[model samples]
Target: MSEHLFSALRRWPDIEAPNLFAVDASDRLILDEAESQLADIQPGELVIMGDNYGALTLGAAALHGCTGIRVFQDSLVGELALASNAGDLADRYRTHTLDRALLADARLVLLQLPRSLAELDEWAQAIARFAAPDVTVIAGGRIKHMTLAMNEVLVRSFDVVNVGRARQKSRTLTAMGARRSLERPRYPATSVLREPEIPVVELAVSAHGGAFAGATLDIGTRFLLTFLPEMKSDAASAIDLGSGTGVLAASLALARPDLHVVAIDQSTAAVASTRETANANGVGARIDAFREDALTERPTASADLIVCNPPFHSGATVHAAVALRMLADARRVLKPGGELWVVFNTYLGYRDYLNRTVGPTRQAGRNSKFTVAVSVRA
Candidate 1:
């Protein structure tokens, strides 16, 4: 067997640590490591907090150690389950915001560094407040993105911070100490004009610390908007699967008032941004914003049309699981006669997945780096 598989097996046991809380269990690396790191721990209950990924909970089961494990994740539990193998594990999973729970009793806390510095600060403050003085807080990320300054924030927030040698282009920061109370930073909101060719409604946007293009409209979204189809009156329901800042959703609502638009994303900030965009455009009544894993919990056979410009990467890793999940969910949620519309870089091979999942996929539009596909359910 490959060394990677051996390492994965070795790391699977560490996830059973009693009272564990992992912030972002992206691909289950830290959760697997936690299980391996504490293989000898006696049977005991475990609790894990994650956004949408429940890798930590699965890690606990793979080790066959935890008396029981509970998971708190966002609304995308269905999507998280899509990529996880923990279907029958002895555990409880709930969909809720991580901030809703207190973490004072957690013995170990693992945080996967997020893309936004503001989110990092928020997580740091939450850890400092809930973690005990001796509790170990480990933050890990790819070495290229993890900086001395980021380490300094951990050090300043906790009592001490130590860096581990890089492995697999990843490094871990070990920190100890009770955090002090500090004022949370307030993020500013901004509004920008859409490209001249696109019609504008009310479009004010406020990004939290970690939003992609929190300060401006991304070129990809601009391209997506320009290519959006003119909605037919029969479009009763539509979904913006990765409706970042609600740009696509807002535009869809403005263009098709008869269609109830549901905008979904995995980030809290993205959800908030979408809601804000809807309200600013006076189309709040027509839009529903929720923080959800686009891969997991789409309305089953609920949408007549689905639109997405799926993100290619999470943080720095070019993981396609997210995009893959999105495609699967779109297939499941679209009515038998519904349509799925997506824009992706031409080289990403999205058509192959669409062909297999949605059937008879074809290019609806194209550009230098992107190809828009419209797949109709057979």
Candidate 2:
């Protein structure tokens, strides 16, 4: 892959690399393409959201020319980069959403299509506000993630939006326009319904104008919830790590009133869903929802139990590093003797990582495609 990127760089030497900004940077084709595209630029400043392998490399290369680079992701990226001597290269690495710093100066912005359309709209609104008239925003995605509606949104936000021919099942959108100030659209929040059949809560989710399957429960999460343990723990504090829509967290809160569960997810939509689910289930007081990157923020050793169904893929890349980082963070925040219960696809090979990082791990249960693993902090 690196060789391919190097070749692309060598081949596309004529494309002037404007100050590059990559959103949702991951360790796959986008990064590879960006690196090849960015190699020719006289390094000045590079901004990226999150630490994917590709983004890290590009940021490192940019640093060689004394380029100012800023990375906004989860805290873990900041910590790892800092530890690896890339610390000084970072102008400001943060844990929240990409701020105006990137929007204010970036001549070219590269964004991977987000999973949700609501998120896409939010980002587009931001771009409309900060991007200059000459600035170009390039958005790319796999065939499934790209759509006419997305193109329409880009057109609405920018003066001119053009969709390029699909290459290798991926497409790029180029939007050029005068910076227009637009208010971010807000979606009405919905409520959830407590299910009597199962110890679960059903969140009433609105589509929020995104590509994600709306209102319906995710199949993977539904599968995980079915296997949730019925054992009552003596521990009072718990966390639903990646608690999308608060399905698992709401269940835990309803089933065990003594345990206080904090639900956290990276997506703003997911956070909103979780909150609504908690409220509808009447567990809002017990379940706290927050927007958080799994790789950032350490919540101390307060959680006696942590539950997660970690995402195996970010963008097009299927990598376990993010999941590994989540495990490490879970370990960091778990009290001594605390339990980390995780449900994942059987092939993810997270068992070995869990065993190595968070003491010995054991398969508590299993199904055809997924396995439940538990690790105890020593």
State the lDDT of candidate 1 residue by residue for 1-378, as single tens digits: 222222332212112233332223233455545554446433332335442344455545554355444344422433344235445553443333435253555556656666566566656666667545556665666667766778766765787887766666777777777566665544435676556434564456666545567747787777777766543347799999888778888888887768799998876667877888788788899999987656456657888888888888654446565577667767778888788888888888889889898867888778887888888877
Q: How many residue pairs clash (N, CA or C atoms closer than 3 angstroms) in each of the candidate models, in the order given? A: 9, 2
Per-residue error for 117 in candidate 1, Å, reads 3.8
lDDT of 2 by residue, 90-117 (tens): 4433323444765665555556666556
Residue 168 Cα positional deviation in candidate 2, in Å, after optimal superposition: 9.7
Candidate 2 at residue 221, lDDT? 62
Top TM-score prediction, candidate number:
1
Compute the lDDT for candidate 2: 0.60
Ten residues in sequence with the least summed lDDT for candidate 2: 7-16
Q: TM-scores, in order shown?
A: 0.69, 0.62
Name the top lDDT candidate: 1
Clashing pairs in 2: 75-296, 117-210
